[model samples]
Target: MKKRNKFFTKKNGFICAFLAPGILLFLVIYAYPLVNIFATSFCRWNYKNFQAPEFLGWGHLFDNYIKMFTLDANFKMALINTVKWVVLTMVIQIPFTLLVALVLAKKPRGWKFTRNMFIIPNIISTAAIGLIFLNIYNPSRGIITEICNKINPGSNVSVLADGNYAFWGVTFAFILFGGSSCLLLLTQIFSIDPGIYEAAKVDGASAWQIDRKIILPLMRPMIGTVSIMAANYGLLLYNEIALITGGGPDNATFSLSYYIYRTALGSTKLNFARGNTAGVIQFILGILLVGCINKAFRTDQGD
Candidate 1:
């Protein structure tokens, strides 16, 4: 019995040794920061005139939560714009990509060349694209005006200057970014059984009917996956805002992620406690939102 016990103990020790590095890495990289943020969230501390943190359980969460609805109008705009960002990106991006992919999958020489060309914008970095748009939107001596000279050089349209146009301006890069999604969907379309189409044709089904009954239904799982991913990406909405208008003309473009970043890192507003509080809240919200999105798509994934 003593010998058997020693053997089992040695085996367990070997397993633990293998696991230790991964466990330690997780604690250092993810778990420790999470715990620290949770602890700091409730503390009353400011960085300007250094004050020792004093824990006031739930106080920071309560204050920020209240301010979101009451005193801060920017919070409300952020929430609204976030919804717009998610909905528009998903709604426009997926269906458009699917359509383009379908065309590419159809295998015309014309379509293949066009498909490659469309991805050029995506190859460019977001910063470069933002800068390009900024120049295009420039009032005088810009390409937009230069092009307009062909018709009438007198169009006073400075596209990015107005608040309403600026909102859509941030989204302009999104409309033509890449054929990445299209390429992904195209592969899936290619994998689908050709016999399915032959069978539909034998049944006297029209092309539209086959697409409606077969292709769209088959693509549901992929579309759901894409939509969820799009929503998550939208939550990290800062680059366009920072590059285009700097959330500007006013606080019109300030997204939640950008808001938290500015509050934490800003020279004027250096509240570490509040920043940690926001971080904690963001972590919770991210988990909840991703959970909900995954749950919504889980039904389609069983196949």
Candidate 2:
């Protein structure tokens, strides 16, 4: 019994030793920061109170939350824009990617080349893409100004200078590049058994019929997965807006992530508590979004 106990202890020790690094990494990288953010969000931590946070009394505990929804115009705009981004990604980006994936699955002429070309944008750094779009939107020497001049000579219209155009400009900068989403959909398409396609063909089904009747239903889970990814990207958008518009033209293009950055670090005031509060809200919204998506896509397997 003593020998058996020693052996079991040694085996457990070995297993724990292997798990310790991963557990420690998760605690340090994810859990600790999340707890700290939630804790700091209820405090009054700003540039003036940098070293430590002052706890808000119970009466004033909800001040930051109330301010974000009621008093802060910029936060309202950011929230609205973030919702637009999420909706646009779900409506436009995912469908476009799914369409492209369906087409590429057909393996037409130059399909391989087209697939590789489509992925180039996603492979390149987002910062590089943002810089490229910024130059393209420049009024002085960019192509857009040249095109405007062609249509109406001497017209120097800056795409990023006007609020309405600036919003769409930021949208177009990242909206059309759905290569990663396309890749995911294409993988799902190819994973379908060839026998299924052959069976559908034998049953007098056309390509479109096969896709609609069989492929789409089978691809629901994958679509939901990709939708979540794209939605999260839209919700947490920052880099493209930061690099391209800098939330300019009357702060028309601010996203939730950008709002957090501006509140916590970018602005002179450095309101860490407010930023963390936004972070908590963003986190809760993300959870709710995932839950809704999962429920929508859940399959009914009646036994």
* Cand. 2 TM to true fold: 0.92
Cα lDDT for residue 267, candidate 2: 92
Candidate 2 runs further than 4 Å off: 1-8, 152-155, 299-303
Clashes of 2: 0
For every candidate structure, what is the RMSD over all alpha carbons to the true structure, in angstroms? 3.4, 3.0
Model 1: residues with Cα > 4 Å off, grouped in runs: 1-18, 49-52, 57-61, 110-113, 117-120, 144-155, 299-303
State the local distance difference test value for candidate 2.
0.90
- lDDT for model 1 comes to 0.70
For model 1, name the residue pairs that clash: none
Tens-place lDDT digits, model 2, residues 189-229: 99999888898899899999998889999999899888888
Q: Top lDDT: which candidate number?
A: 2
Each model's TM-score? 0.82, 0.92
